[model samples]
Target: MAKHYALASYADGGDWRETEHLYVPRRDTRLRLQSLMALGYTASEVAAATGLSPSHVCNLRTDVVHTTVHVFTADAVASAFRDRWDKLATGPQANRQRSKARRLGYLLPLEWEPGDVDTDDTTEMFLSDPSSPETTENPEVLDYVAIAEAIAGRRVTLTRAELSHAIVTLQDMGVGVHETAERLHTYTRLVNRYRARARQDAA
Candidate 1:
């Protein structure tokens, strides 16, 4: 049996039906999707987890033009993100996804906090230009131990902070700038820039 409900009347005597479809700003949803990819989860994997189509997941992750997303879609993605945020995906596809995300400068899962995920300030931080003078002035902290551990791994993937720290550490150990660049598999100019910054900080 189908039941019909009467619409509530406003003070002016006009009746309106309640809306079932809801939408929300897509910023946080996009970030969550991107973070999942950065953690090595491919679009298909995320789609499988969320029951969303792979194309839909990819669109949401890459399309900044869309300002809003359906509420249910956002909820599904949020659920998947909560479940997989700290877990790194495996396999060749996952490695490809991580490489793509890294090339796009997406933030890693551990780089964001639960409280900061929905904030515009945090989003701006991720989107800011890394080569800007302001960015060069206030660099991320150096962690030599973390850099060493990453270097020791079979698959090496170091963040910009870690790379900078490695260059500085190598230079401090009397390694030539060219040799440091070769060891880190980066450009000589970059090694020089980082070394220059380290010297400036020391001064």
Candidate 2:
């Protein structure tokens, strides 16, 4: 009797042994997907990069019961993660993705290094990283009242720095000058002045 091996052709047009297609543990792959989502990459973005379905990428990010995945699937996710781990995704969809990941308590890219993703002790290591957002005890709180007054045509008593910070915060949240002025019941000229001051201070 002789040992037998299964063979198949892959997309690269190379015949590979069946052993090469065996499912592998998906812990690292799942973490990588979650980390990318935490960094604001939407499932659709990842799917586009890896040729996986968006729903499949979402499942891999949220599902924990499944313990294994196809080798090719893992490889695709790994390649996508490597290319995007350090980049912060933008746009409404990316913002939603990041919010969902945060609500689900997924680990951030800064929490683990390339080699740490597969290790059981990565959570502990993350806690020790001073630069990690998780370790920030006193994150800067934006001045909501100043922002509200600036938008409502009410007399604002905030300092110059505080008012500038409020304008910048609104800008960062994707609120444009027209919207801010409309909300404040004031002219866009006022909002524009604040925006200009904010930009100058930022630069």
- Candidate number with greatest lDDT: 1
Task: State the lDDT of candidate 2 residue by residue for 4-122, as single tens digits.
Answer: 33322221233444454367788878888998888788888899998999999988877889999877787677667655553456547876877888898887765565565554332
lDDT of 1: 0.67
Per-residue lDDT for 37-84 in model 1, tens only? 987898888999888999999999989898998766776786677556
Clashing pairs in 2: 151-184, 152-184
Position 60, candidate 2: lDDT: 83
- Please list the residue runs of candidate 2 whose C-alpha ends up more than 4 Å from where it truly belongs after superposition: 1-21, 113-116, 119-203
- Poorly placed runs, candidate 1 (over 4 Å): 1-21, 113-116, 119-203
lDDT of each: 0.67, 0.63
Q: How well does model 2 score by local distance difference test? A: 0.63
Q: Candidate 2, which ten residues in sequence have the lowest lDDT sum?
A: 4-13
